[model samples]
Target: MAKGGIKFKDSAAAYERLAADVAARRFAPVYLLMGEESYFIDALCDRLAATILDESQRAFGQITVYGRDTEAGQVINLCRQMPMSGDRQVVIVKEAQQMRGLDKLSLYTQQPSPTTVLVLCHKEKSADKRSAFYKGAAAHGAVLESVRPRDYEIAGWLAEHLRRQGLAADGKALSMLTDHLGTDLSKIANELRKLLVSLPEGTKRITDADIEANIGISKDFNNFELCKAVLARDMERSLRIAAHFARNPKDNPLLLTVMALFGQFRQLFLLNYLRWQSRHKGLPFPPDGELMRILRLNNPYALGELKQAAGEWPNRKVFAILGLLREYDAKSKGLNAGGMSDGELLRELLLKIFLL
Candidate 1:
């Protein structure tokens, strides 16, 4: 197993090490997996529990405990015991964040048993970095910090996920999935798995049609397409899509639509600000690589449209549009909204954005 530094590591890097160790049967003394992103933590835990020992060995060697039902001292006691029927014992602590006096485990973490593989599944928050337990784990074992990916990064993540499954998705399909599913990795993964299962054998590519057919997301009238239409100032197409959304309020929640627009306009506002800085202050726009890195933009193709929009929309207009989005977002949440239907608010917001 790869060793961790005296600090937390990013989820991807941490999971890579955990996966490698599990695959090789190289057990670490302790694994402190903590974060808001539970998917990776749960996944690593499942793999460890399933792969560390054979069924017969596991019957005696594997121990699973819930933090709410156990204390740090009990966990420490369990970690100290010798394996009964195998070369090593696997002790998994799920929801470790709920364990009272988790800091008390510092004493045991300082010198964990080499024959014991202690797994801590701390969900929804990270361990305290300043705590002795965190330091001890980092020194003796490994710490994995799972974080939720941002909205713009989802498409890239989905694409990579599909690639791993021997399937590929185009930009439009990626956009449609992200737009509809938002940034919940678990949900997105589940939906993609369903799509993959629905496909014929040896079908390697996922297209808009596949998405539309399997996921029930429209290829032409989704929020992704709506954003493109509005950015291109294609009023007819933009209003048409908005009308579709207004009609299908159940699938296309008005709040989500407004938030999507808000995100789009916010991106445009940033692009406009960068362009202005480049022209007036002699500052350069970030290189494509840096721009994607800083902006969390996975698709470079979207940059072309963004660049064009940045040139077309002045800073003032971008600012105004942002303010309007904010207002409509509030109204969509029923803040100062005088009983207007979601469809009405959406239509009104679209008109105002188009005018801007």
Candidate 2:
């Protein structure tokens, strides 16, 4: 069958597939790329323009519009246009979530032009499958893919992506970039691009020292180092990093770091349980790669460490730890009497994690 739906683990794979499909001129009547991850969506759309449409056709037939600026009537008009010296014309509606006449466009979609390709890019969420537009698109054989990248996978991908750019970052540098950027690819790419432009040609190795020097983050004090300190159970380093965050809450917000730390611990606990029971029963913990894919966990020692740590805790302690994080989250947002600096609060939280 020529029509099918597939999801990739991350943006790189998504782009690779999109390029291949577009190269083969296997364009679908309707293509829906929806996700919080914008990099792949942008790249896929760009690929369609650069490769699928010839220069002369693009001048007259390829139309790129934004939801906030363009109306649905214009989109429908473009869709109805005859291709100029090309097999098909492309209509890309970005931020399609903001399009005013999406309901109107649905009527035209019932019998779309075979010589036209419509791509709707909605970054926040998917168009409701029950809606007329979604239904019409699918009934006419559309290609739909969701581009959500897991947090852990981002770190791993960053390293590989950097290598492709002829730049190399060690594990610590990659980890630091993830911590500093907070899992946003656009921002990360922007920052990395800035770094590369300023670097000498043929520069390959990027270290923690170079990052701190260039990015203005303290080498000894950052989210990655703090997370490592907590994971390693080095309370002193954790407290020191907390103190730094407390002093400069604007730079290293306490809420984000706390959330990241707790997320890591929660993943460890889950994997811990999975390892213990799955091994004894001789059954796959995740039954497949489902849990691994979802968690984005890759460390060799991760399962073993989690098993050891989980064995030391009772169920009540796990619940209590979660409760503590919830309380802190609320208090941090000014729900309670939250006067203390993030560093002091994080220090207390690190102590709690260590105790657990």
lDDT of each: 0.84, 0.73
TM-score of each predicted structure versus truth = 0.89, 0.76
lDDT of 2 by residue, 1-356 (tens): 01133444534675666668888988878777666667777777777778767786788778889998988888888888888766788888999988887767787678788898888887776676678877787787454455555566677778778766767776667767777777678888888878777766777898888778777667788877786676666788888888888888888877778666667667766766667677787877673346655556544344444445556554466667777888787767766736876666777777886787
Per-prediction backbone clash count: 0, 1
Q: Cα RMSD (Å) between model 2 and the true structure?
A: 4.9
Clashing pairs in model 1, backbone N/Cα/C closer than 3 A = none
| Candidate 2 clash pair list | 246-343
Give me the runs in candidate 1 sitting further than 4 Å from their true place. Answer: 1-9, 277-295
**Candidate 1 RMSD to the correct structure:** 3.5
Per-residue alpha-carbon lDDT of model 1 for 1-356, expressed as tens digits? 12233222356657877888889987778999988888789888888899988888998999999999999999999989989986799899999999989999998999999889999999988888889999999999987888877666677667776776777887788988888888787898789879988988899898999999999999998988998988888889988998898889887887778767777778887887777798899998899878766656777888777887776777798789889888988998889888988888888888887787
Clashes of 1: 0
